[model samples]
Target: MDLCFIVILLTFDVKSAPNPVNIAYTSVALSLHTDLVYMESPPGLQLLHCLRFDDCVEGGESTYLDLFHVVEEFRKSHPRYFQILSTIPATFHKCHYDRENPYHLVYQKPHIILNHRKQVVGLNWAPPFEGPLLVEEDDVLMYYEAYEELAKAIKNSDKILTYGMKVGDLMIFNNHRVLHGRNEFKLNDGIRHLQGCYIGIDDFKCKVQVLSNQVGDGQPPKHVGNQSWL
Candidate 1:
């Protein structure tokens, strides 16, 4: 991907006024969500580099949840709800003003995406951008109930990891399989800034393949089927 189009530098500081564009621009706690759920094909890999983290700052711990495990647990406990969420499409929208390019983006996709073998592979869940009910009236209640259950599980799950990122910390994760958020923070003595960039999964995979071919014998591994790339 072109560096000019793929990189996004993010600065998290207390703004004078609330920006309706994104919650990350504010100091409030951001809910656990997958980035760009409003897009049909969201970025695959996310990289965050912390440039500044003052000791005076409080409550700015980063949290991450593994959606793959969450979905597995949900399927075991609430099979029907899992089925509904995996099949029904929900609409997500983002309408914000940009001086250079104002935009309103919308997309419809099931909260859980499955692979050809019916295995959960991707997810799209963002409460902030979730649009109005797209399902029938009869199914709305069930949908919300399932949604609420899932949300609660994500928040209360013991697997969630919280880390206070320090200066020079770089965090990278698979955007498709992980849900990320941050706690409400207060900037007292210094500023908090983070630079970020996205790399397409295909590009990353190609690089890995090239490296492997250059270093390995010309034959594929015999245990390839047992290996899980994701």
Candidate 2:
């Protein structure tokens, strides 16, 4: 099917290397993030198939947090910070000229997307891909303050779901509603191989809604990867 077409299913192996093209290919810990925030319509869902995960790997546990939950907590505890992040525009980018997969992309959006009555509707958060903030001078300090609070909230949240994968394990999740990261891993004479790909959010959501009508109690799911609060 068109939705499941795989262009070779981009693969990545985690092993100790002198130099790595993508940071994810090394033994480094990643901060909370979603993929491709720099794309206008980032993928809605992600699938990672683990071809191998050796027992000797010390860490490398994947962590996830429901972004909507984090945002809701932030909106309640730090309304002003929430306001700043929701109103100010931030740019994210993916640029490379001398790489095999060359790409140059820039997308600008408010950190938090709001609808009428200032309700949280969606999110645009990917710290590693964030580009020059390029905000008004006065808003710079305010933006940083807001960024710090949100970052702190994420770091200290207790709702994080952590899981360590085994060989043949597959992980599927909503890219828009979940913020995921990795724990620093030590590959002790072992290697980790993973292949991943994405599916359009629109298609995923359509099937979810359709399934709810047919198999569920004829009620749409409360959430289908769209960051809608209600």
The TM-score leader among the candidates is: 2
- Model 1: what TM-score? 0.83
TM-score of candidate 2 against the unseen true structure: 0.89
The lDDT for every candidate, in the order shown, is 0.75, 0.82
TM-scores of the models, in the given order?
A: 0.83, 0.89
Candidate 1's residue-wise lDDT over 50-101, tens digit each? Answer: 8887788888888998878888899999998998898778899887776346
Q: Please tell me which predicted candidate would have the highest lDDT against the true structure.
A: 2
Model 1 score (lDDT): 0.75
Residue clash pairs of candidate 1: none
Model 1: residues with Cα > 4 Å off, grouped in runs: 1-20, 98-100, 212-230
Query: RMSD per prediction, one decimal?
Result: 4.8, 2.8
Which sections of candidate 2 miss by over 4 Å?
Answer: 1-18, 225-230
